[model samples]
Target: MNKYLWRRIKYFILCIAGLLLALLIWGVIEPYYLDREAVVAEIPLLSPSWQGKKIAVVSDFQIGMWMANTRTVAQSIDRIVAERPAAALIAGDFVYKPGDNLTPELDRVIQLVRPLVVAQIPTYAVLGNHDYGAKAVTEASASDIQRADRIQQALEASGIQVLKNEAIVLPNADRTAENDRLYLVGIGAYLPKQSQPQQAIAQVPSSAARFVLMHNPGSFAELPPGTAPIAVAGHTHGGQIRIPFLPEWSWMSFVEERSSWSWISQIRGDIVRVSGWIPGYGNADNRLYINRGIGFSNLPIRFNCRPELTVFTLQAKT
Candidate 1:
């Protein structure tokens, strides 16, 4: 009888071990094979005159790995441009890693999309935590900083303005005149080593219709009261996994809280909260739009959530 019990226990242990191994592979390795989902969100800001303006939002294209095919990336950009937005906003993470030789390929991708940038629509970008991973990892070498600089130069040359805790006003159709009706503010990646967002938003005229570009959603919590009308971000990558009924602690939880997992709630008081600009304020306001992102991070697979190119139409509230 004792011998029989020992045999049953061994089988149970083996089954548990096998299940664990499968889960590890699914989470870290096989995830790259999953298809990414594309989604669009229409947000209304405080601007009544600027309503009907369309803005394209793209974020977290790690580039070389999941998006290695320049043609694929180009095609995606073409589709986005087809929407004819007044402006394009990139939330950050252009390159996968510092040492990765994605320059030539990235340059090619940029060339395909160059026409869109040079077009009437203004294109703006900000760095993400991965862009400054070398700095975050602590062991990053001098070469890392040099690589980061090179990437920045290339992106700028491509006509995509890279904002590092800075603000730039986008002129309306008049070109020569400053359009106080709308403003674009960019905050550097929320990584502690980078510039602070509080300082970046300060550069913009507070009275204008403020549209903030930030990489991580968490940065919204740091903004001063009544800063911007809407803040855009993409770093959470939509939790990278969206299994129904399961606890969200799977993967993205390791980074920011689950609040970082999706379009977050807007905080409001004397200041405009990130969620305020949404359809509703607090839980109701449409304050922030977090992109699911294009490329894969850490692991190569994506399931349920396909890569997305977000086109937001800003209409005047009736």
Candidate 2:
């Protein structure tokens, strides 16, 4: 080969090598890096006394997955404790494929989340599809119910309140007056039709500031207008591998469709909505925020998407 052609060949080889190295770091190293995102939310009807209080949100531990990011989960919880948020919210999917034996996974999950209890930070959670072992079961079976209950019991034992279609008024450090209270409503997983937004919201007094916690973003649609001033969710994992400018190529699409992958879904942008605020969702009064959780599913690698711990500062709406 001539000198110019040889130079061209060398350049081509170097470009290919560089691309592989980038992909390797993105897919392997990125997943292990946890991101702490701070956001400010202005909630309607929020009490002045509760203004500027921070709430930490994390989700989808998926403990049993091969090469799961359990270390990240533990570290994230520790950070939440250190931040000393008024409360920490776990959006769910505590284990991945615990199968018939859930004891080991449950123990691992409890151990990872125990730090929050030790730190005395109030924590709340809701179960996801994986926790119920009903990823594919639209109608929950007896086994599924048992699995969900076991997971819930373990979390509760570890000092995390597992709310299923329940609402509680968060006690304010200042006062217990009606105007000072903020309601937190947590509903069940949307998969298997377990989420009951109406029933959960019923417990919240009207004209009070309320926030909802759920495992699936789909549940936000079930909420009536003005019921959820703000809501938080997980289970998308930010598409697990978000291709820049090509969100439609997310791997979550395949998992959601589950054997019915289609060009139409891609063209219509039906891929799972990922982290941060979801635009044009729910009524004008309802807002939803999805957290990018610190775990893996379908595969253990993540590219262009890092695990997240969200710290939200609540501001009283003007």
Candidate 3:
């Protein structure tokens, strides 16, 4: 009887080990397969002049991270341009962990997305926490100011507009510019010293058709309910790895929560009240869509979850 029990225990241990090995392989290779999703948002206060507009949104490019492919992002840009989107929006984190290679990193990042400028897509962007050297494990550093400046300059040079705590008005062609203006508000990075959401919305008119761009979902809390028609973000990277049906048990969640303490929060108890993983759209007055993002942050492995490219079409409510 004792010998039989020992043999059974050995077999069970071996099975667990084999399963773990298979999962590790899946995680390591999954990131290469990029995924695309379509976002259709209905804005009640949308400008009739700007109806049926298509916008492309991407975020968290973390270019310098291990195993993150720049080519993949360029290909995604190709796809976006093919759709002929009116504008492209980058939520933030153009480069990952610049460390001492700030200039080169920024240059490469710009070069990767230059095709958008060439396509005349009028790309707009907002900085993410990583762009300012702020991570889940650490706060923004003093020296990150230089990194942030270089990123902004590179983006501007590429003809991509950078917005921080500001608003811009794009004239609607169908109607006269006087009354039909599209308001785009780019909020600051959701990090210390740079996070100024109130100032970001200060200039936006309540009546103008508005869409808020942010990198962190945490910033979504600042906007008044029902006032913001749509807000897009990408800090969570779609949880980096989403299991089909089992979200709470996703391998990334166990490690991800540790990297960022505030990963769990209560925003009317609707901020991913799931198993704590699986990134998706949430219903609210603002109607937020958090893109899965294109790059990896702390970990290089991704299983079930792939890099995301979101193409959004804005429809005005009748």
Candidate 4:
């Protein structure tokens, strides 16, 4: 081959090699790597009594999925147990797709998370889109719904309080004041049928310091202001396959959010209305934080963003 042709051939070879190496990192290594993030925030309405309280959050365990790492799940839970946060919140997607191995998979995930139960932390959880077992974001069959119900029961049996369009008022550990309280409002997932932020918020007293929990960040728009000064969710997985700083590059988002190229904006706009209002393009009040969650769905690869387990410390916004 001539020198020019030889160089072109060499460049082509290098490009192929680079692609393989990247695949190795994204598909193999990154999925298992635990990215611990401090979800620190000072919300405007946080009560003085609940100051300096910490809450641990995990999402998208999605066990039984093709690339769902059970080992990583243990590490994340162990770390949270060690931290001994005042409370722990699991944002759903505990089991990926309950195929024939649903029974075995549920057992596996329950064991993996039992440590949290034994640790005695006030834990809470919500159902995710996948948990519904629907066909591409639509409601699943009765059997699928039954499967989800069983999983919810199993989780509750493990001592994790699964919240569904409900509010639970947990007393402040400090106990300095008789009336000190922290409200936890857990809403249903937005994808299938059970998303009702309105119902959950209606039960919470506006003056109470509350934090809303849900699996999908898209539900943030449905939440009214003052309900949750800071809402926590994880279904977006922070755009699981983010491309450096350009969100548009993350085409994988479309697949997960149930949209086609034709009406991507409308779908996402409906799903993530909050992303448009915040200063950085998120919730209207900038009170929502979408956890870059752990586990993968459909695809095993993750680039730029690693699996996450977040610890949030909240103080009154004074």
Candidate 5:
């Protein structure tokens, strides 16, 4: 071959090699790199005392997935403790699917989250479909409900409060407060037809300060207006293997099979919100923040989307 032709062939070969290396890093190495994201959310209904306090959000710790990111989960929990947030909210999917032998998997999950309880950070959680032993919303069954209860028991025993269609009024940062408490309304898993947003907030007064937590972002629509000044959720896992700016081409786009469940279609676009805040995502009066949780779904790989631990600093709107 001529010198010019040889150089052109070499250039083509180099380009292919570069592309392979990039894919390797994206799929293999990126899954382990935890991104500690700091976000600021303004809750107009928030009490002055609640302002400036930080709340850490994380989810989708599919602990039993093939080659799960357990190290990343532990590190992320440690980071939350170090930040000393007012509270830590775990969105759900504490386990992928532990099958009939659930004890060892549950034990690992407890070990990972024990620090938040030990540090007295007032951690709270809600269950996702995976935690209920169902891979899809339509797959939920009575057996799955029993499985979910076992997981809830493990989490509560670890001192991490798990809410299922329940609401808790958080005490102010200082112990002296008697009123103006911030309400934390946690909706249950969308599976097994367990999530009940209306009932979760029925006890919360109309003018009270509050936020909503659930595993599926689709549940945001069920919440009444003004009830969720801010809502947090995890389930998409930021599409697990996003294609960066071209999020429409994320892995979820290709992998999501057609389903009768309305929410299944929206997940392809949810990857766009990846690791930060989205204002007025559901109801114009409400805001939603989606966290790119720390684990895998069906595949143990992450591309541009790194595991995330979101630290949200609360500010009262004027």
Candidate 6:
């Protein structure tokens, strides 16, 4: 072969070999490293008399992703249990895709999460964009809805209350007519296709000490004035990547109007509410905690940002 042709051939072979090596490394190291991140933040929310009661937050269970393993998720739940939280809040995306396995995977999740519920920790969940994305996999809108409903049902059966833009007052253990300390309000997925936030917050009493749960962080914008003391959300997955000094703009840029990358924002209004991200607790009122989600999305690889299970300790400010 001519020198020119030989050189070209060698370069091409080298390129292919490099690509293969990169893929191999990613396949082996990605799953273990990406899937193995400790639950980062332990937020403290002060109540009048409640001192050390903790609420565990688990979000973005994008099951069925190539990078996410069911075992890892179960382990994460186990960690949450170890924290001995008073309650567990799940912000949506229970399934990666709507498929025959979707229901089964959801069932598996229920079984794994059942112990936590049985432990008497009030578990609450809200749907996410992916849960409703079953239309893409099922091909039929009705089937998608049915599949989502099934997931919800399974969760409820396992003792997790599925909140669809509804408010449920959580009674204190004291049950004393005097100590009405905790209230949990959940909003549905923040899709225009699903329920509306305005309608959801309407159900909650403005004067109550509320913890609002919603799928998308952006939904906080729509909350009625003086709605909640703390809002928990999951969807951004901490941008899925963190570069040194450079922000993860891939998802933030497009979602700027809908969900800004700002993890914490104070909603100035009659009530002066605050909306904070719940994936990894960015720059919000120290009250908002954004969990770095348990499952993977789109690319199936997590860099810098690892999955997290957050535990928030609600204490008395005084």
Instruction: Residues 157-247, candidate 6: write the lDDT tens digits.
Output: 8888999888887656744443455667788765435656677767755444567788776666666544554677887776654443454
What lDDT score belongs to each candidate, Candidate 1 first?
Answer: 0.62, 0.84, 0.74, 0.75, 0.81, 0.64
Please provide, for model 4 over 172-195, each residue's C-alpha lDDT reduced to its tens digit, 9 standing for 90 to 100: 667565347778899986777677
How high a TM-score does candidate 1 get?
A: 0.71
In the range 8-68, model 5's lDDT, one tens digit per residue, is 9999999999998989866988888899888887877677678899889999999988899
Question: What is the Å distance of residue 273 in model 6 from its true position?
Answer: 19
Give me the runs in candidate 5 sitting further than 4 Å from their true place. 1-14, 173-178, 264-275
Candidates 4 and 5 compared: the better one by TM-score is 5
- For model 3, how does the per-residue alpha-carbon lDDT over 1-318 read when each residue is reduced to its tens digit? 699999999999999999989988988877777777887777776766677888888888888877766767887888888988777899998988867778777777988889899988878999988888876645567678777877898899779999988989853446665557777889877764576667777788777777788887767667666656777878777667666765444444456545442534433433352221223333345667778787886788777777888877889865
**C-alpha lDDT of residue 198 in model 1:** 81
lDDT of candidate 1 over 1-318, digit per residue (tens): 699999999999999999978765665543333222333333233454466667778777776665343444455577667777778888888766655575664675477668777665678888776666532413434665566667678878878788888887765663433443566788866653464778887876645566778887767667765565467787766656555444232355455444333334443334322211333332223256667676666666544455666666664432
RMSD to the native, candidate 3?
3.4
Which 10 consecutive positions of candidate 3 have the poorest summed lDDT? Answer: 273-282
Give lDDT tens digits, candidate 2, residues 71-122.
7998898899889998899998999885788889988898898889999888
lDDT of 4: 0.75
Name the lDDT value of residue 200 in candidate 1. Answer: 84
> Candidate 3: where is the Cα deviation over 4 Å?
1-12, 136-142, 171-175, 248-263, 270-284
The backbone clash count of each candidate, in order, is 27, 0, 0, 2, 0, 10
- Which candidate has the top score in lDDT? 2
Look at candidate 5 and give me any clashing residue pairs: none
Provide the TM-score for each candidate, comma-separated. Answer: 0.71, 0.91, 0.87, 0.88, 0.90, 0.74
Scored by lDDT, model 3 comes in at 0.74
- Cα error, candidate 5, residue 140 (Å): 2.8
| Candidate 3 TM-score, true structure as reference | 0.87
If both were scored by lDDT, which would come out higher, candidate 4 or candidate 5?
5
